[model samples]
Target: MSRTRFKVILYLDETEFSRAAAIYSAILMMNMPNMHLTIVRLKESNQSLLEIDEKCQNIWPTTSDVPQNALDVFLARSKDVQQQVLYSNPNIPDAVTALLAYVNKWAIDLIVMGAGEFSKIKEVIFGSLAYSLQNRSPIPVLLVKELSQDFLEGCNLTPTLTIVPKNQHGN
Candidate 1:
């Protein structure tokens, strides 16, 4: 008999929200024995899909082979995670469409992302990535917003695992 594993996709980027998402993904996957984690990054540029994939692969190294310089230490605790990169047109519609396609292609069981550190005004004008993904994605999304000091203390996380909140502009 074959066993089915839960596929968890984490939206990754250089944002605090993404860091929160990574933390949530790592902890969740670590607790679930039959889970597969994949960190997905989307680039909004004119780059071809092939080029985007290559770049993503470079940045999205697997847990075992991930370089020491990678920012998220939570991921290194688990060795079963992988990475993927997708590219889309700079437009909102196109980006959402491409993200949806990846969800379907991977049969992703769950989508996890940061709650986005966008200002209220900016989120209203241009929805944040988490907002966009939540609105358009077919799968359930876990939007991790903050890591309380208590939780970090309980986890006994290292300095590399520390995640601080970004400003409203996500800077």
Candidate 2:
């Protein structure tokens, strides 16, 4: 069978460390030969996008704070392909809206995101981003606990092997 193209959007924060980790995890978990990855850093202002995208060649930056523009660009660029948006921060409403817009506009097939790191008390009191996404996202969303070095290294393997345990029946 022919390989299908995949366009993945990774929403990153200010720190490059987390972004790097997320990117590495995405490369491993997605494991599509025709995968195109774009890293978008959400900041307080518009300038951060240029700084991150330009200064850091690896990450694709965007200055559009409004959700529609971000989704439009993603959809227009990744036509006739599987599209996904992965965000580390679940509380950011802008990010949520952007992801939703992408799904609506492009009919995105999957969304992969890292689990939020909020306390149960805080989540119960104020609600959690992960919870919101899980409850509201239109398509399938795979929430990863943490991205490890081994997983990143495994991504480089020619034929990646992901073992999923079978049920007791062991079909």
Candidate 3:
């Protein structure tokens, strides 16, 4: 769809890595003012939604511990921002079902997450969270490696895939 009104869900969970996703989302938001961003903060069973909400409400107005924290606080205050706790469960491969449901309900264009590198063999055997989303998500799933300035120019990207199909002649 158009980047002007792109709907993005920054998948933030318990991982310290989620900060990267938040920063990436913020950059994209800044670049495209019309872009609608929803921060999905995934909390574990130890935290109640009430507790999380209370803490966020407190922090959004007062938190300036870090640049990322301040950015998140500002984002939380923005009218476009939608903070969803989703469940008592944590953000894992198991959470994909709930996330997919949300994606369908809101028509999310993309799911941006911070993914830690894993061995191919490990992923093939046990599977990883990122791969799980990649395989399952109907919409595009972005696993942020590093922030790029390309997003600053509205990300006019046309990705090229290496895979090619054989012709009827089987060249």
Candidate 4:
């Protein structure tokens, strides 16, 4: 059987340090021969989007607070990593919708996003995007824990990994 070609959408946010770390971890653990990565940033305005992308693209993987040891490990292990940037307006629902639209347009096989820190009150009131994506995305959504190196490695061993069809469901 042919190995699956993977398009990994790395969801970027204002908290890019954490996002980059999660992406780094995913890239290292999955280590797919055919994979593409795009860094997505959601903002409150178009201008903010541009600003955020510019700042993020420049600061990522460099100024990012990812540990030096982890950075070394990622660079050494994930040679096939590719990067792209996307921008979207703030509205959480709108941003997610836009992200899903982009994912479908690119025929992305997987989405890798970091689970941001959330207060219990906020989570209870607003809900978690990661949780929502796991249940709602058409394709598999890998919600990563901050600086967790073993998560994707665990995913790699799971049997019968399902690839949801494009038209199967709407996120």
Number of the top lDDT candidate:
1
lDDT per model, in order? 0.66, 0.47, 0.62, 0.57
Candidate 4 — number of clashing residue pairs?
1
Clashes per candidate, residues 3 or more apart or on different chains = 0, 0, 0, 1
Ranking 1 against 4 by lDDT, winner:
1
**Candidate 2 residue pairs that clash:** none
Of 1 and 2, the candidate ranking higher by TM-score: 1
Residue-level lDDT of model 3, residues 111-139, one tens digit each, is 98878778999888777677788789999
Candidate 1 per-residue lDDT over residues 19-113, each given as its tens digit: 65666666675466567787777776676432237544435544343223233543554455777778887766777677778778779899887
Better of 1 and 3 by TM-score: 1
TM-score of each: 0.72, 0.49, 0.63, 0.58
Off by over 4 Å in 4: 1-4, 14-30, 46-61, 65-80, 117-121, 147-171
Please give the ranking of all candidate structures by TM-score, highest first, separated by commas: 1, 3, 4, 2
Which of 2 and 4 is ahead in TM-score?
A: 4
State how far residue 61 of model 3 sits from its true place (Å).
10
**Cα misplacement distance, residue 50 of candidate 1 (Å):** 9.5
The count of backbone overlaps in candidate 2 is 0
Candidate 2 Cα outliers beyond 4 Å, as residue runs: 1-3, 15-21, 24-26, 43-95, 149-171
Residues 1-171, model 2: lDDT tens digits: 345645454544444334443544344334453555454344343332111224443333433321233333334343222222243233456456655665566455565555656787987788754556667887775565565678656544233344545553365
Instruction: Sort all candidates by lDDT, best to worst.
Output: 1, 3, 4, 2
Off by over 4 Å in 3: 1-4, 44-77, 88-93, 147-171
lDDT (0-100) at residue 6 of candidate 1? 91
